[model samples]
Target: MFDMENTTVLDRPMLDELVPSRYALKIGEIDVLVISDGVLPLPTTMLAHNAEPAVREAWLNDMYLPKDAFDWALNVMVARSGGRTILIDAGLGLDPDLQLPRAGQLMKRLEAAGVNLGSVTDLVLTHMHMDHIGGLLVDGVKRQLRPDLQIHVSAAEVEFWRSPDFSRTAMPPGFPDALRATANHFMEEYGSHLRTFESSHEVAPGVVVRRTGGHTPGHSVVRLASGGEGLTFAGDAVFAVGFEQPNWHNGFEHDPEEAARVRIDLLRELAESGEMLVATHLPFPSVCRVAAEGEVFRWVPVFWDY
Candidate 1:
């Protein structure tokens, strides 16, 4: 008997338990599912380097989050349209040095959802950040994926990783090195599968990826439109704290200033258009709409579809 709901993978005791790891919904004609890649517990300081300690602390306290560190959600998406199945971002695989053990749950969760890697026709990377590409580098992932898999990413993103700049950004020790190494490894192993794009490219009907170049020189976002509904899968272009403090700088940003500009522009556009938004680091399922409230925007999570 194939009881996918009860089947377990990777032998992770916690993963054996039944939990809400996947959410399914439709964007007009396309099928979309947001899977939880678990969470990454990062230092609170990473939330905003430019913010005053007092002001940042006040925001944290108001949100009831711990002052030291908090868990950041890692969300991955799978979209199907026009006979093409696309993976938006690969979740973190194994990063022993980063000490983030909980976040690499994407592969297992996808398996439980009956999503076979071999069926993925295209992979659209928002950027080459480890959290977004590491899962593909996992030991046996390549073997399971089809040899002709077409990976779509911004040419700027592929070029920036050659000599990534970390001077302007702030991150914990060892992160820069780990990120660089993982990206290098990924490129070396999968570069042949890449299909670089300049600014934007359409992968499938109503599914398009556009370069934003803020979070990373190659960072991009995926937009899906079909029938009359629409949605955008923002890859690290926005965060949980971004809604309240849009100007705050994230430690992981390669170019914080440009990143802020990109964030504001995307939020404003979504707010005005009234389209659904999903982001990598936002809450699970991450299905929400942006509300323009004077200066800062507001996040209005879609009422649970179920």
Candidate 2:
């Protein structure tokens, strides 16, 4: 059994010291590390799309969070099993043109944690969001970071982004073009190395990918099982205030209603089973568990060894 007593919680001051930028944990024999890619500022209004201003403010107030914007963390999970290094999601790469100024720190932080980029054998993408796949390339040209990297993504996700109609979708002003460009870039750069899978499949020894589409056409989650312990990498499936209000759809989701439905069901299952969840856009080191509270749910962040 995994020991919960050794877990430590770092305050903002200690976190700022960069000592807690990465968190280490183990699921059975698989060694896992949660690396920070820095935080990005996102308007609270954009996140609580379906909620009224008053309601959203109340929720933020309850959580002691800012009313206008949220400092969302970009956490990338790395797992080592059976002598293979697997990266769950690539963080925002070192792209100067990207709007978010605080992101794209994955490589540096990983190095600080003693991880080598060239050692990554598998890159698993939960979805194709810019923040998630940005690190797949360095400045949109080099694929030389990982010599043996094999890209894995959902088949549906590939089709959605590659479709000619993708550029004509009703997306935020400049997003459609950006999405098309990123998709085309990946196809051109990693076409031969890309591997698409169906509904649920084991990507690594103890890591399994399950399609939970809603946030995006190919949105999915990674479930790691070993030594009688399990943790789920909930890729944009839930964000701040999302655990408390699973039905509140975010503006970023391609299908808001479906996203809500998927979030509700997934949160319910995780809460009941007490599985650890590593959220991509929650607080730094975004490892938490869910607890069913009446009709909603609550976030219970894990404490790691300091």
Candidate 3:
């Protein structure tokens, strides 16, 4: 039985003053913070499954979020522990090619949080999507954030993004090739730091990689455990829990069925285990818990009064 109601954790403010959307969670001696790079607006039709027009329209209308547009919050997580700074996903770096407004605010927020990119020793890439890996390189040539940090990505993910299959498909315009090139650049610049993890292996002492393929072929999630606290970094597995009702597929999922399955399983696991989760596309801060009532699942924002 999952608690479908909000917990006492939400009583506190979760975000920092510099970036109102970003939030920080403390686990033992580690500091895990989620920073907002920006947001985007997409069509609701692109997100809905082939369902009744009236029903979907009604749902969107009731929520007040325009059916013609869906707002997606972009976030990147930074982990600091044992004097080593690690960044989970890079946000959309400044790019004339990308239309998203939240592009390239990592360094700004980091500085606001009193963090220097040069101190980062490792980078854990959940997947190589443009929004997630955009900040990996700066101005398309320099490694701006972390010049000396090791960048770890799953081998399967690396292969999939680099494959010609991506470029050959009818992907959203200007998405495939540019993203592929970034992946190649990362591999080249940080080959020594570029390591791969199997399906379920520990990347750091308290951070482990869990496969949750769907958004991308080799997409996965990150689980952080330290002391008595636990949290999962659900990268695009379940965007806004609103449209992704129950165990439904996200509209942009490459393989909708796979995305639905992975999301359902993840919700079930989170509900049963009572662990915390932070999704990239979820609202800023994006931290919540899954609650199961009968067959319907809901996201209960963690009451983190920071």
lDDT for every model? 0.92, 0.79, 0.70
Error of 2 at 55 (Å): 0.8
Kindly list the per-residue Cα lDDT of model 1 for residues 69-89, writing each as its tens digit. 999999999999999999999
> In terms of TM-score, how similar is model 2 to the real structure?
0.89
Residue range 74-160, candidate 3, lDDT tens digits: 888877666667788888777676656555777566656655677778777878877777675666334454556677777778777
Best by TM-score: 1
Q: What's the number of clashes in each of the models?
A: 1, 2, 6
lDDT of 1 at 67: 89
Inter-residue clash pairs, candidate 3: 9-303, 9-304, 10-303, 10-304, 12-305, 38-102
Residue 164 local lDDT, model 2: 37
Model 1: per-residue Cα lDDT at residue 219: 96
* C-alpha RMSD by candidate, in order: 2.6, 4.6, 6.5
What TM-scores do the predictions have?
0.95, 0.89, 0.84
Better of 1 and 2 by lDDT: 1
Instruction: List candidate 1 stretches off by more than 4 Å.
Output: 1-15
